[model samples]
Target: MSVTTRVYVARLAGTAVFDPIGDQVGRVRDVVVLVRAKGAPRAVGLVVEVPGRRRVFLPLTRVTSIDQGQVISTGLVNMRRFEQRAMETLVLGELLDRTVRFVDGSGEAVVEDVSMARQRTGDWLVDQLFVRRRPQRVTTLSLRRRGATLTVPVEAVTGLAATTRTQGAARLLEAYEDLRPADLADVLHELGESRRLEVATALDNERLADVLEELPTDDQVEILSGLDRDRAADVLEAMQPDDAADLLHELSDEQTAQLLELMEPEEARDVRRLLEYEDYTAGGLMTTEPVILGPETTIATALAQIRRQDLPPALASMVFVCRPPLETPTGRFLGVAHFQRLLREPPHASVGSILDSDTEPLTPDATLGRVTRLLAAYNLLALPVLDAEKRLLGAVSVDDVLDHILPEDWRESHDERLDEEASRG
Candidate 1:
C-alpha cells in the first residue's frame, strides 16, 4: 500500500507486473489497470485463455509480496510461468503466483495491472486490474497516447490487475485499459486538486499530454500549477498547438504570460499565434503543425519526410505544398492533394498536377461560420487556412472546431436536452 514502495518487483523491466503474485499463472494473459479513478487510483484484476490453454485465477488472497514491478506468488502458482500446469488448490496467500482468472460472474478479459487496497479490518485486497482489448473500450484507452481517433465509453469495464505481461514494447501499458477521458475528468474532479497534481507529476510526458487533453480546463490549470513552470510548459509544448491553446485560454493573463515565458521561444510563438485568433474561429483554432513543403521539393522527398515526422491527421490526409517558415509555412500556396493520390498517381508528378485547385482555403482570421461551412461543403475533417498572400498559415480539423464550440458535457447531457425539447413540443 506504500505509494513510493515497489508494488511488484521484476528484473526484465523496471517494475513488477502484479503486486501480489500468486494469482499470475497460465502464461499471464493480461494486466488491467483502472486509470480513470479520480480519488486514489482504483484498479481491478483479470486473466485470458485460448482454445487449449485453460485460464488461471488470482484471488485477492494468496498474493503476499510485491517487488520491483513483478508480483511474487508464495501461494500456489509460484513466481513465474515455468511450463507447469499441475492443478494445485491453495488456502492462504496460497494463490501466490498462481495463474488465476476472475470469475466476475461475467466472463474474463486479459489482466493488465494489480493494486492493493486495505479492507475494513486493515487486510489488503488484490483489488485493481488493467485489462487488454477483449472489451472495445480497453483498446481505445490503450491508444490514448497514440492519438487514435475513436472515443471510448470508459464504462464497459466491470472487472482487471498487474499479474500478467502486456504485449511487446508496451511494458508499462496498463493505465489506458478501458479508461475514458470523461471518467478520468471525473476522477480529477474528485481528487480535490492536490491528489490530481500528485498523479500528474508522476506520469510520463506523453501520458501527461494524453491526460491533460482529457481533463477539464479547471483540472488542467490545477495540475499545471503543481508542476515546475518548465515541466508544465513541456507538457503543453508536447500537445498539438490548438489543444495547448485551448487550455491556455482558460488561464488568467498573468498565468498565461508566465507559462508562455517558460516555454521554448519558437514553441511559444506558435502557440501565441493561435491564441491571438478569436477563441472560436478557424484561424484561431487550426493546428500550426502542417505537412508543408518547399516549392522546389520533389513529391518523392516530401513523401519521405511525411512518413518520418508525425503528421497532423488532416495534413497527412491532405498534403499542402508550401515553404516552411519558423513555425508557419510560406510562399504562395499551391493548394494540396490527398497523400494517397500522390502515392498512387506517380512519384515524378509535380505537386501542381496533384493540387486540387477548386477547394479554396480560408484565411487565418476566417469566421467559424465560414470554416464550418467549408468543412461541410468539402466534406473534409480539415482545411488549410491561408494568410493575406495566400500563404498556407495553418489547418483546422473538424474535431478541433467542434471542441472549440461545444460544452465538454455535450455527449453526456445532449440526450436529456433532446428529450426535454420533445416533451416541450
Candidate 2:
C-alpha cells in the first residue's frame, strides 16, 4: 500500500523525530498544513518539540519515512522558531474538535478527530474528517442516544477554515453556543491538558467566564493558573462575583491576592466582599449581576434591558428597583418587579408603582436553611441579600440553594456521564 493509505495523523502526532544517523531530534508536536482553494490542504511541515529548547519547524520534504512510531528526518531541520503563517493550519491544535457546517445545509457536526495520508508526489493530505453528529434527544429518560460518527471529505464542510483558522477563538466558541455552561464545562474537562489549553486559549474572556463558573473548583483553579496574568484578570472580572470568589477561595492566599490585585478595582471589591462571608451563607451563594433598575424606570425599559443583556434565566425572572450602581452592589434596594408583573402592566407604567416588596429580603448572614425556607414559603425564584443598611448586595438564585440541598455526590454523577461518552467513543 502507498504511504497515503497506510497511517493517520492522530497516530503520528506523538511519534519520535530522529535525524539521518538515528540521533533523536525531538517529538512531533503538531502537523502544519497549507490550506488551498480545492482538495485537501498540503501538509507543509512538522512542529518538533525539543527539550529545553523552543519548538522548531521541520519541513515535510526533509522527512525520509514515518515507520514504526518513528519519524526519520534528512538532517535538514529548520532551527528558526515555528511561527504559524497565514495559510498554515496546525492539525492537532486547530482542526481537532472544531465544528463545521455541511456545504449541503444538512446540519453541523464537530470534528472529533481526523485522518491524513502521504501522496505519491511526496505531499501529505488531510484525507478525511471524523465528525460526530449531535445526538438526538428522546422525551423519555429510559432510552439514551449516542452521537453518530461520520466520515466525510474536508471539501464538503464550511465554517472551519480561513477566518475560522486565523481567528481560532471565534471558531472554538461557535459550535458550543447551543450548549449549557455545565455541558460545555464537561466537554472541556474531559480533554487532555494540552488540548484543554488549546481550546481555552481560543475562547474570549466572557465565554470562558461562563464555562469556568460551571467547572469544579479544582479544574477552575488549574485553568485560571495556567493563563497569563492579564488574561486571567480579564476572565476573573467577567465572572459573577460569587463564582469568582468561590474559585479564588480555593487558591492559596498569595495566589488569590495576586489575582485580586490584577482585577478591576470595582470587581475586585465585589469579590472581596463575597469572600468575607462564610461559604454556607446566603451572601456566598448570591450573584452580583442582578437586574436592578431605578424606581422611575418604565416597565418597557426594564423589559428591554432584560432582553438586550440576555441575563440568566434566574436573574431575568425579576428586576430589582435600586438607587445607583446598576451593575454591582448598590444603594437602597426599593423593591423588585417580576417579569410576570411587567407583562400585566402597561409599557408606560413606572416599575415603582407595581413593585413586589412584600417578600422580606434575606440578610447576608442568613443560613442556607433559612434561605431555603424563605424561597419555598414564598415560592420565589430569587431573593435579594442585603446589608445592615439595606443596601442590595446581591441576589441568591434558587439554583444555588438547590446545590446545597442536593446530595454531595451530584458532581460524581455528572462525571460518570462524561465517562460513558468516552466509552462510546
Candidate 3:
C-alpha cells in the first residue's frame, strides 16, 4: 500500500496554492468532493480564489503535493470559472461546523473540523473528525467543565442527526452529511415525530429542497407544514419547479395559494406553469436548466462552458442547441450535440454542423409512458421537452423518469437496506 498524508480540511482553507516552480497562484477557498451513498467521498478538486479573477476548480490530479500550508501542482491548471453542480459537495460550506451523532448513540457533538487524507488509493478520504461533545444538561456540578473535544474516526458516526430541537438544530443535522438527500429523507421518515421536526427545521432551504424532492407527497406536505410561511416559500422556491408543483398539487388550495403568495413572483410563476400540466406529463417532469447553446458555437467554447458549469455527469454528456434568446420557452429548438461527437471534431467545428436532428423531441404534454418509451428507444439520458411553437422549454432526464416509475415505498425499502448494512458494519 502507498503512504498516506493526514490534513485537516479547515487548515487547507486560505492556504496558498503554488505551481511546482514555487510561483504563487491562488488561495484555497473550499474543497470539493463527490458525495456518495456510503463510504468516504473522494476529494475531486479544490475551489481556489485567484487574485483579481473568479474562483477556479483545481482538480486533485493536478495537485503534486500538499503540505506546509501550501498546495503544489505540476500540471497546467484550467482557469475556467468554477460553479457547483447537483453532485459536488463543498466541505467548508456544507460540512464543517455542523453537528454529528456518535456511533454508539450516546449524544450529539459539534464538528470542529474534518480530518482528510491522501490514501493508498491516491484519493482523499474524510478519514476523521475533531468534535466537541454537547453536555446532556447544564448543571452546577458540571459548570466548570465544558464539552471535551475529541478526534473520532468517520466510521464512528452513525448518522447526521440530533435530539435537540432548537432553531440551531440545522447545524446538528449535518451529522447525516455522509448520506445523499434520498437516504437522509428516509432517515428523517423513520425518526420519531419531535426528532423529525427538529431535523427538518434545522435544514436550510437548499438542503431541505433536495430532501423534499426525495420524500413522498404526504411526507413533503408534513415537512412543509412544520416551517413558517416565509421559510416554506423559500424552500419551495429552492426546489425544482416540477417537484415543487407536484408537492403543491398534493396540498389544499388554501395552503398552496398561501405559500405561492409568499414566494418571489418569478419563482412562483415557474411553479404555476408546472402546476398547469398533469402530474404525469412531460411538462411536469422537465427541468428548465439544460445546457443550451447557439448553433454557431465551437467545440472548444462548448467544452469550456461545460467545465465552467461543472454539470452533473449525465447532463454534461450532451448539449442542446437552440435559436437566439436561450432561456426557457427560448427561440426555436434546433438540435443537440453529444460530448463524444464534440471530441471527435476539430476544436473550431461549429456545433450546428455536428447537430443530431434526427431524434424526435417530446411535446410538453407527452405522457410519462410515451416519454419513457422514447428515451428507452433512443437510449437517451435526457430528452428535450418543447412547446406547441417548437420553442425549447426544458429537458426530462432519465433519472427523473425513474423516480416516477419506482414503487411508492421504494425509499423505505432502500432505507432498510442501508440500515442492515450499518448493522453489519
Candidate 4:
C-alpha cells in the first residue's frame, strides 16, 4: 500500500523566492505546495520578488525535487539573477532582486521589493511586495514597509493551490473569479499578450465590457482576436457603446461584418453607425450608451434610477439630464443637467432648474486638439456628442480620446533614442 505525507506553508503563505542551488537569486512572494494521497509532497509553483525586475515564474521542469518542506530547483532555467535582503536563506537570498508580480493583468510588474512579517499563525511570512517607480534613476525597487499590499481577500483567490504545485505559465482566469473591471484591466495590462488573451477568454460578457473600457485600444484588439465571432460579438454588445466602437475600428471589414452578424440587431446597428465615422475624430470616439432622462424628471426619480444601476456616489456628481423627446431634431438629444446641481437642490426639483447652462457640447467634426481643449473648458469626462441638427448622438470620455490618438510607439521611440545617445557618447 502507498503512504502519504503532509505539506504546509514553510513560514507563512507568502515567502521570498530564491534559487535552491545558487548562493543568492531572489525572494519568494508566493509558493504553491502540492500533495496527493498517492505521491510525494512537492513545491509546484513559485513567484519570486526581486528588487526592480519583472516577476517571472520558474517553469516546473526546472524543479529537481521537493524536500525539507521547501521547493528545490537548481536555478532559473533561463538566466540567473541575484538580490540582497536581510534574514533570508540561500534559497531566499537568490531571489532577492528578481522581480515579482501578483494578480494584475498582462505581464509581471517589475518587482520592487518583498516583505516578511509575523502572521497570526505565530510564524514569519510574506506580507506584501510591490512594483515601484523612483523619482529619478528610471524604474527601480521600492522595498519599503509600505509597499506590496493587495486589497483582494484570500477567499477571492481561485486557483492558487494548483498554480503552486504546477509550474510553467499560469492562467490567472482559472484562479480568480469576478474581479472588478479596473482591477482586471490592471492585471491584463501587466500580463504578457498570450496570457492576457488566456484570461480574457475566461471573462463573461459584462465583465469583459467593464475591463474592456480600461484597456488601451490595442489591448482590446488583442483580447478580441482570441475569441470566436459569436463570443466576440457578445463582448462588444455588452460594452459601453463608445468602447465597442473603438474596438470595432480596429478589426478588418470582413472580421467586423462576421462579428456583427452575431450581435443583437440593435447593438449591431449602433456599432455599425459609429463605425461609419472617422475613427480618430470625436464622432468616432463618442459613447452612445450614456444614462439619459427627461428634463421633467425629479431628483428623487433620478436618484432611484441611480440606485438601481448601483453607480457609485462619485459618479452621481452629475447624472446627464436628457430630453428624451421624440419630435423633429430628436428633442430627446438636446437636454442636459449636472448631478452636482441636482444634489444641491431639493429632491423634488426639475432637472431643467438645476441644469448647468455652462455645459458646452461637441460635434462630430471636432479634432483631438479641439477635444482636449474642450475637456479643459468643461472639466468633464462625459461630454455630449451632437449631430448637425443639435441632436445628441452619444457621449465621449477624456480617456477614450487619449487612448485612441496616443500610440504606444512613443515608448519604443524613447528606448531607441536612449540607445542612440549611448552609442554617440
Candidate 5:
C-alpha cells in the first residue's frame, strides 16, 4: 500500500493497526508528538490499545502505510506499555479543542483537528490545523452566531505549545462527552498531574463537581486546591452537601474555612451541618438535597420534580413526604413515597394518601451498620434521615452506604488490578 502524504491525526483514532502479514495488532488511541520551541511538532508514535487493554507505543518508523480505516506496520512491535515523556503531547487529548489566536489579527478560533505531513526526509511533522472561529456577538442585533471553519497553516495561529498555560479542554471534553462521571474520573486519574489540572481548570464548575465526587479523596483535594479560591468554592456549592463535606474533611482546617467563607451562605450552611457529624454516621452520608414534597402536593408535581435531568438516580428513586417547608429541615416528616408507587397511582392523587409511613426513618446519629441493614431490609434506594423532632433533614442513598463499607483504598486497588492484568498479558 502506498503511504498517504498527509493525514488528520484525529481521524486515526480507533483505526485498526495490522502487521505486515495482516495480523491485527491493536487500535489507535492517540498520536504522540514532540512539540518544538519555534515550529511544528514532529510525530513521535501511535498509542495503541492492544489486547488486555494495554496501551503500547508504535513508532512511526515501524509503520508501512496509513490508509483509510487502517494502519500497516512492520511485524516487529514492542509489547511494553506506553508511558508519555515530559516533552511529549497527545494530539487528541491535549491539543484539539484548544482556543488559539490567529497571527494575522483575525480574531480567536478553536482547534478542531490537526494534520501531519510526511516530509522528504521521511519524518512526519504536524503542519496544518483545522479550526473554527469563535462565535461572535453582533452588537447591533444583540445576537450571537457561530463562525466559519477553515483549514489554516499551523504557523498562522498561536497557543499550540505544550507549555501554553491557557489551553482549554473544549475539544477534549467533546471526545469524552459520552463517558459517565466515574469513567471520566478514571481517565482524569490516569493523566499526569499537570494535564489533569489543566483539564479540570477548563471544565465548568458543575461538570467538575460531578467528576470530583467520583474521584478518590486525594485526587479531589488536589484538583480542588489547584483551582482559584472562588472557583473552588463554586465547585463545592455545585456538589451534593454530603460529598462536599466529605471532601472538606480531607483538607486542613484553614483551607476548608477559607473555601467555606467564599461559598454562598445558604450552600455553605448545608455543608457545615454535614461536617458536624461523624464520618461513618447517617448524617455524614446523607445528601441535604432530596425530593421533599408537601402532603398536598399532587403526584403529578412530585413526578415532575424527580424527573429533572439534574437529579441523580438514587436520589430520584423516592420522594420524602413532609409538612410545610419542603426544603431540608422540613416540617413534620410525614412518610415516604416510592417512585414505582407514584407511577401506579392517579396523577391527581395526593402523595400523602399513598405514603409508606410504616418504614422507620434513620436518626442522624444512627450507625453505619444500622443504615446498611435498613437499606437492605427495605430494598430501598434511599433512606430518610431525621432530627429529634422527626423533621426531615436529608436522605442517605444506597451509594453512600457502599462508599463507606468499601475498603479505603478501593480506587487505588482498582488501578492496580488493571496494571496487574496488563502485566499478565
Candidate 6:
C-alpha cells in the first residue's frame, strides 16, 4: 500500500473501503495493531464492516491505497468475521481517551487520536498520539486556558498500558455519535465486558435506554446492573414499557421489584401490567406508549404528534384513536388513523372522521402467531390491542413481534452465521 507520511487513524473511521476495480466493499470501523513490548505498535489491518453488519479483517498488505475518503484494496478479501486476538489493541476503540503522562512528568493528557506512519522497513506503525493536556489546578482567580491539544511521539507517553487506570469514553463516544442505536449496540457488543460497561455508563439515560433496547437481553441486563439503582431505574423509565419489561424478565424477581419500585409510579405500572402477560402473548410484545388521540383531535394536531423524531417508525405509522382517556387502557377504543390518511385530509378535519375501523384489533391475550398473521394479512406496521371492554390497552408493533419470533440468541449469532456461510460458499 502507498502510505502517506502520517495518517491520523481516527479520521479514517467510516471511510469507505473499495476493491481494486473501484467497487465499494465496506467501511473502516477500527484499526487493529499488535502492541510490542518496547516500540510503537505494528499496524496489522483494518476492521471493515461489510454488508449485514459483519466486521471482517483486511490485512494492510492487501490495501493498495489509503487516500482521502477511501481505501482501495487488491480485491482479494477474506469474508470470515473478525475476532480480536489477545495481543491486539483497537486504536479507535481502546487507545483513544486513555489517560497518559509524559515521560518527563509534566502532567497527564487524554489520547485524542493516534497516527500511523510507514517505517524504514515499509511496515506501518503507530508512532505518534494527538492528545489534549489535562487542565492543571489553579489557586489564583486569573483566567487560565483549557487543555491544549498537540501531537507527540507515542514513546513519550506513559500509562497507555495500564488497564487499572480509569479510561474516559468521551472521544470514543464522539466518534460514534452518528451511529444508529442498533449499530452502536453492535459496537458495544464487540468490546470487552469491563470496557463495554464503561462506555454504557458514559451515555445519558435516554441515549442509553435506546441503545439498551437494541442490545441483546444479556447485555441489557448487564449494563443496567452496572449502574447505580437510581440511574438504572431512570433508564428503565426512559425505555419503552415493553422493552423495559423484557429486560426485567431476565433479572431476578427481587431485582426487578426494586427497580420497579424506584421507577415513576405510572411508568412502573405499565411495565408491571406488561409483565403480567405470558411471553408469547400479544400483551407481552406491545408498547403501552403509542400515540393516542381523542375523537375531537384535529388532523394537524395528530400529524404534529406523529412527527416527533423520538417515535419509532412502527409506532409512528398510525395513531390510535380512542375516547376520553388517551393513555393506554384508554377509554373506549375508536379506531386507528394511519399517517397517510392524515396527510391526505385537511388540517381542520378531526382524526375520527377518517378511521380504519374495518381492521379488527387484537385482544391482549392473542397469541404471537395470531398477531403475526394479522399484521401480515393487513399489511400493517402496528396493531392495537384492546380489552374485552373495547378499551385500547397498547399497540403491538411489527418490530416487537419479529424480535419475539426470532431465536433467542439471534442478535449474537445471526451476522456471524451469515459470514460463516458466505466463507463456506
lDDT of 4 by residue, 38-134 (tens): 3222343455533433233554345444344344556753322212122212212122222333343322332233333333433333333333322
By TM-score, highest first, what's the ranking? 6, 5, 2, 3, 4, 1
Instruction: Spell out the clash pairs found in candidate 6.
Output: none
The local distance difference test score of each candidate is: 0.55, 0.76, 0.77, 0.54, 0.86, 0.89
TM-score per candidate, in order? 0.57, 0.60, 0.59, 0.57, 0.75, 0.94
Better of 1 and 4 by lDDT: 1
| Winner by TM-score | 6
Candidate 2 deviant stretches above 4 angstroms: 1-178, 324-329, 407-425
- Give per-residue CA lDDT, model 1, range 91-147, as digits (tens): 111111212233443333433333345456534434443344343345656556432
TM-score of decoy 3 = 0.59
* Candidate 6 structure quality by residue, lDDT tens digits, 154-273: 899887766544887888898888888988898898888888888898999999999999998888888999899999999999999999999999999999999999999999999999
Better of 1 and 5 by TM-score: 5
User: Model 3, residue 185: displacement in angstroms?
Assistant: 2.5
Candidate 6 accuracy as TM-score: 0.94
Tell me the tens digit of each residue's lDDT in model 5 across 251-285: 99999999999999999999999999998999989
Deviation of model 2 at 76, angstroms: 52
Poorest lDDT segment (10 consecutive residues) of candidate 1:
89-98
lDDT of 2: 0.76
lDDT of 2 by residue, 1-425 (tens): 21324456665665788888999999776678877787777777887865533356888777888888898888876555455675777776667666687898777677766677777777778778878765444445524654678888888897666434322333334534555567567556644555566677777798889989877666788899889988998999999888899889898999889999999999899899889999889988998888889999999999997785647777888998988766556889888999999999999999999999887899989999999999899988999988888889899999888766776546435333333323100
Clash count, predicted structure 3: 3
By TM-score, is 2 or 6 better? 6
Local error of candidate 2 at 210, Å? 1.1
List runs of model 4 lying over 4 Å from the truth. 1-171, 189-195, 307-317, 326-334, 405-425
- Quote the lDDT for 345 in model 1: 65
